[model samples]
Target chain A: MQIPSPYDMIAIGGSAGSLPVLAELLEQLPVSIDCTMMIIVHRLKNVPSDLDRLLSLKAPITEPEDKQPVLSRRIYLAPQNYHLLIETDGTFALDYSEPLHYSRPSIDVSFASVAAAYGPRALGILLSGASKDGAAGMQQIIAAGGTGIVQDPASALFDTMPLAALELCPEAQPMSITDMVHFLTELKMSAEHDQ
Target chain B: MIKEISNEELETLVSLIHRQYGYDFSDYARSSLKRRFQRFMGYAYIGGVNELSDRLLQDATFFERMAQFITVNVTEMFRDPLFYKTLKDLVLPRLATYPTIKIWHAGCATGEEVFSMIILLQEAGLLERCRIYATDLNAVSLLKAEKALIPLKCMKDYTQNYLQAGGMEDFSSYYTADDEHAVIHSALRRNIVFFQHNLVTDQVFNEFQLICCRNVFIYFNRQLQDRVLRLFYDSLAPLGYLALGLKESMMFSEESIRFEAVSAVHKIFRRKS
Candidate 1:
């Protein structure tokens, strides 16, 4: 049997200076992106956050419960203090495991699990962060034949994370926040056109 | 390498755990449980659910370790210091009117919060009248709690948390630190009782003036959370305090009506008379 088009999931990971860029990116994203999108950012455990409400203005975002189905064409933000994983059946898995790289909602955990669940159909994006947490997971995504993208270090407020990602996936295309939004918009248009 | 566990495989393991050990994990959130099992599998180098089941059946020692792994939770001393401050400023004062106080720290992994509570009681001069029951499903963690030794590395952070929680005295005074570890002062350990108590399979043995079961219910499904909340409610004395993790609340359960929020932002609730 022939496999379907490999563009089922888009996962974005960031930390430190992600909010403004994320807002800009979300603002530019069209309603008909044609795939499931998930965002993971480092957050302090036990602290209440208003991220879901803030992001919901752009697109209806769900802070999915454990075992909830990960549906297509929707945006999901990982709940604070929970390591979000993508199950093989395309559902969300929440883990309260010890913090990885001092982060409970570690970008690494989400990226690796996304790669495992969606394989070549996934696209992993790494943005600004002060740590090298997501580098290995980004590499895993690339190794699994999924596309890996990173914000250009020069444009990122905290360059360590993007630089680390670049070190792991040397061939990954780097884009500024504006360029990333433009590139994704083009990708979505072409994907819709293909249908 | 860890492989994805199929639905059938997951059901088999959950049933096996229930049948063989009488531990009820069936009601726990399925995705979280699967992730935890997968984590254990990765650590133990067990390839698949069948092999995990086989190893668990053959080796009792492995089962003991597995049980520890299942119940182990990541915790920090004086986590969300403001919550501790609320306990000190509001909760503890109300409990002080009682002739004697009984506090239960349910699922007290590694006993950090238990120690934090003891410190609060001690500083308030209420430690002598307080009887603390600290329990968890993991016996290994209970023993570690009994030891009351924290890594020296974490002491600084814990101290900062202590200060943020409004410590009147120097935070370092509560522990004796060497190069590698900080052992809580022996005096603070006097009123504490650590034991193995599985919330899923255990019954309430004592009425408590205050029950702190933070960060435990997030792992459970709604049904399990409701069940546990009811258990907590029954175990609490009239007008007693029930403290939950920041993310957890009784609002989602039928039990919410029976309790009033002492400080909703801090997740402190009191049983209504």
Candidate 2:
């Protein structure tokens, strides 16, 4: 067995039309992929969020409970109106402070925190969104020497987010939804091979 | 995936926090607690959980910093404006009937909510009769709360929230601002006491007519949530009110039977006689 890659935390942030892309991406991944995934999507507060349930159809997913330990192969969604952060120990930290850019679960807050917690071990992906919220966070991830990925603006339903991210991380690999799925599978396979 | 903090290391750290500091975080949501421990380790520049434990043993200042981290301290004035609006429209009228009003702001970080409550009571003509005990486990936050100064950058956002929450006067009237910070008017600070109190370790100090414990319980595990809810239940006067964060609820708690929702939409409840 090949040694497992240190990159295990996959932090994804998106809004607007990112759901379909997420659904598709998860559907393509093998169920036994040895990584922990966390997704932060703009969501409505007070009303119970069903994003976790909706996405779990494609993969095992849950809204992380306060301080819950992050589990491999399980997908975690930022709870409605909470910013999802990672502690250095790789457990989930949900923050209920004022919404950033009028968004709870602000992509910047989560991305920056994850970069700080995981540094080079983090893999951050920016997806479609109407706003430029995730750009600075993507910069933080790349600055920390973590890999940064962006959805190709041409393929995004809303290109504003990806364009903004590209401005900060010119080196960020832009992938189409289908290509992104293949990339994730290859990365997983490589990690497994190393183990 | 990265290996999680070993259970034995986690237990030793929590035990140290409990034994040395007397703050019982053992019942806090374990996953969140572990996450916080990890963040604390990173912040302290330690490489491992065991190293963090050793540092805690060697350094007293680390405990003080840990107190700040262990209790999450993000808050804003009039958060969830609709909840405040609900209080103004439906709850304040009932509070006005009392000759003297006492409120407890559990986990009152940096005191923004405390000031927001004062503003509402002042506008309702109830400020003169109201006394609020705002408490938190973090002394540094309590000190900041006592100072009544917040970054002026947030005032714009807070102003909008104040208006949406149904402010009767100009929001600017509540504070004086300079280039970097805004200091709440001294008038609103009257009858408000900022103190260090631990929800997990402290006993009920007073029976309150209103308890505004918002957004704090979501950080706790279910067991701790139940224990804290029961404490609030025991500390409330008959027919008193309890205002929770819009996302928090007592429905799943053992004390749920003791109170009825004042406005279920806003998570406000009134103790049933």
Q: In order, what DockQ does each candidate have?
A: 0.31, 0.16
lDDT of 1 by residue, B135-154 (tens): 99887888888888898998
The ten-residue window of minimal lDDT in model 2 chain A covers: A1-10
What's the true lDDT of residue A191 in model 2?
68
Clashes of 1: 0
Candidate 2 wrongly placed segments (more than 4 Å): A1-12, A15-39, A43-80, A84-94, A97-126, A129-154, A157-175, A178-195, B1-4
- Give the whole-model CA lDDT for all candidates, comma-separated: 0.83, 0.82
RMSD values, in order shown: 4.6, 7.2
DockQ, cand. 1: 0.31
Classified by CAPRI criteria, candidate 2 counts as: incorrect
In CAPRI terms, where does candidate 1 land?
acceptable
Q: What is the Cα-based lDDT of residue A117 in candidate 1? A: 77
| Residue B86 lDDT, candidate 1, scale 0-100 | 90
